[model samples]
Target: MRAYLATSIGVACTAVLVLPLSLPAGALAASPAAPPSGRDAGVRTGPGAHSAAAAVPGSTESVPLRPLGSTRAPGGIAEQGVAAREVRPFSLVGVVWDDADDELRGTVQVRTRAVGSHVWSDWLEVETHNQEHGADPGTQERDSGTVRGSTAPLWVGDSDGVELRVRAAEEEDETGPVRPLLPRGLRLELVDPGEEPEALPYPPSQNSPETRPGAESGTATGAESGTATGTPVSLGTGVSPASGTMTGELAGPAAMSAEDRASSAANEGLTELGAAEIPALTKAAVAAQQPDVAAKAYAAPRPRIITRKGWGANESLREKRFGYTSTVKAAFVHHSATGNNYTCKQSPSVLRGIYRYHVKSSGWRDIGYNFAVDKCGNIYEGRAGGVAKPVLGAHTLGFNTNTTGIAVLGSYGGTNPPAAATTAVAKLTAWKLGLHGRNPRAKVTLTSGGSGKYGKGARVSLNTISGHRDGFRTDCPGSRLYGKLGTVRTSAARYQGR
Candidate 1:
């Protein structure tokens, strides 16, 4: 479980860096305006940090970390060393180091090239605070475990040679002296994201009780649609078979501006058509009128969950087909770790970036989070398994199994998450957990898989609805979003009829 490459980087290691420069050639920026930051989780966006690599012809030589400039920092930069046969062909790369428990000790960047080509991609910065990147200790490398401190995985299409640099930290903005620590146990990892088949479309839609439009998608809930006479009637129990107690809130959901939720009141007399017949329900599906009949007494309304099929998810990109856990007892919320620079329409592409980063770069089987929510409140299916089942996620370290990870699609550290995003979390958990008959407001004890703050097999009690930080040491789900967990939990419980 340890890929510890004991390379001796002197306390005097130094490197030159140009500030405010665009990423090196072959470098890609998801958002140019955003600054750089890191944590120990999956969905991170590479913002302001520009990356670049060497343009030298491909060789068997390994480029070493050379001294660049010293900002009164302790390190004076030395030749960390070079490579001979250590360079091999691989698609994914990672940098690992020891921090002795302090925050981001240093910065690690890498560049790669095809086996025989001289062209090199721009340098990609590895996340230094990657302590929580691995699965729980004693599990699969791609699943979870301890790797001390590591860098975020970077993907270079095809390469045989590599160059890496771990420069000292720059000066602080307060114009004070910066004494950076020379990280120990620095090494580079070359990962081969196992090959897999391209995604295949699902078999033609069938009438298998699963409807794409109404109930499953969490449309408006209340008394059923009535006949043309306006007689109040019960609709087909707007609930998933697995969910019975989810009597959702009808106010905000009910008050949904004649959009988001399709009102059954207007379609009382309309014929019930299969999801294939109507991909996206028409505006008529939403209703604005008050419930004419007695309101159902359930706690939460089943959210209109968008299945993987609805968002055009490309299943083939993942290395693993589908794996399942026993049950989902806890729901951990997280932020994509990427910046808040994308629009709802661009969510799919944003997903693509994360998917590729997780699989090809991060070296995981699929996306880490089980589900993703956009700022606009659109929920996109994550992982390949059925949402109804407990899909093991690589989101929370030491707690990936038996837990579901729902990541909002933007970094929520400094910026506040939109209200739509928060409400979506409540709607989703209400039904999903309700399927498992979980009381959202209850507390559950789960054994730590290992290597986080908790010891392996340690029974730790956690809220049924919790944040990623609640289970691990990283500031995941961010400060702002984490601050609103109380509201999310309360909303979820209310939806669950708690």
Candidate 2:
């Protein structure tokens, strides 16, 4: 993908950032400072020595799958996977291959041993047809030459031992049963989200601003005072040229990378540099920014959203620059399919794991979705440009150009989605869609960029708010959750004053 340099803020495009690649213990700082009691407590603090695992940067272990031999299956199973064995601690797993264009026409199942325990769990299925969510087939991001085919990541909590299998589907032929060919380069990926980073302080202060082309007159952008008046400002120690605030790690050139500055600058209008979360805005506050839309009574109150920083994202893990599309025409909803075994308290860890999987394991530039919601109704920023901007996402394959993706954490194929989760989806869509003057209840036609269900340039009409299955032939946003789209649309429209 084309990387947008932070030249606007004086960040040199050629700056090199050297980072460590060691897989430290407690690599994913995943656990909360104080985990909740009961079942969740056990998940974070498993019985035995693992309870005190040190927090450190996360790591990935990719093991090749091998044939299990004739003794394993009745039909001489046409399968490939690793036998049960102990290894480093990891909380998520998936299968990936070298070719992004090749599809895995088979089933993937994995079983695991809980960290520090000998008990082995039953085999759990992984989503094999997850290629429906990716960059458009021929975009620079899709053709970045590093993309790969991967299954939906499965969260298995803390585990040190794993057994996995990938079985090809058998079909009846004239001679007998025949098995289809499996994709090449099949490997099981074990992911450790690593230790969660320390939470940044709330109400983050803007960092010290650097010299800009037009700022020699002491005048600053409206990011600080909400209006770009020619106000004279003093530039000194701990003083921001835009807003005289304390200079922190995020603003100091020595402390921040060029990528970090660009990311923070993208959200300058909505938050201060290095802010953890974007504060919720009342309808009046939102209306004040758009008087015309307010006069038309067609705006939704901005929802509170947790920034990537709030979720402890290691920005260094992703590509150094950002990508963007022209506008957000629709919102495609999805279910993480990572299972519902986690508590709201562990949501950040979940996000971090997924982020790491999408980048390091799946061979993507960043997390596929634009936003993520927890079962408890918390909203988080997904891809790193700007929440309000049309940040090009690796979601909805052919439809990634002008649409945003919102994934509610957890699988919903059999289980019903929580009311809070659906409600948060509605609230988020209402505000984000309103920004582009889209009516969640309206229908819009989008041209396909080449997906399994549609060819490039094929025009299809769909809801402004639709499920992941709407654009592809996969069971995403599951049946139970997909059924809730109607309610989400109605609620979002109402919130937008439609």
TM-scores for all candidates: the values are 0.55, 0.77
Error of 2 at 316 (Å): 1.0
- Best candidate (score: lDDT): 2
Runs in model 1 deviating more than 4 A are 1-104, 107-127, 141-299, 309-313
Which candidate gets the maximum TM-score versus the true structure? 2
- The residue ranges of model 2 lying beyond 4 angstroms of the native Cα positions read 1-56, 71-77, 173-176, 200-265, 291-296
Worst 10 residues of 2 by lDDT: 1-10
Query: Cα lDDT for residue 454, model 2?
Result: 89
lDDT tens per residue, model 1, 126-192: 4454556444455444423222454544434445556666666655657675656455555555543
Q: lDDT per residue, candidate 2, 70-114, as tens digits?
A: 523334446888876667788888888888788776678887767
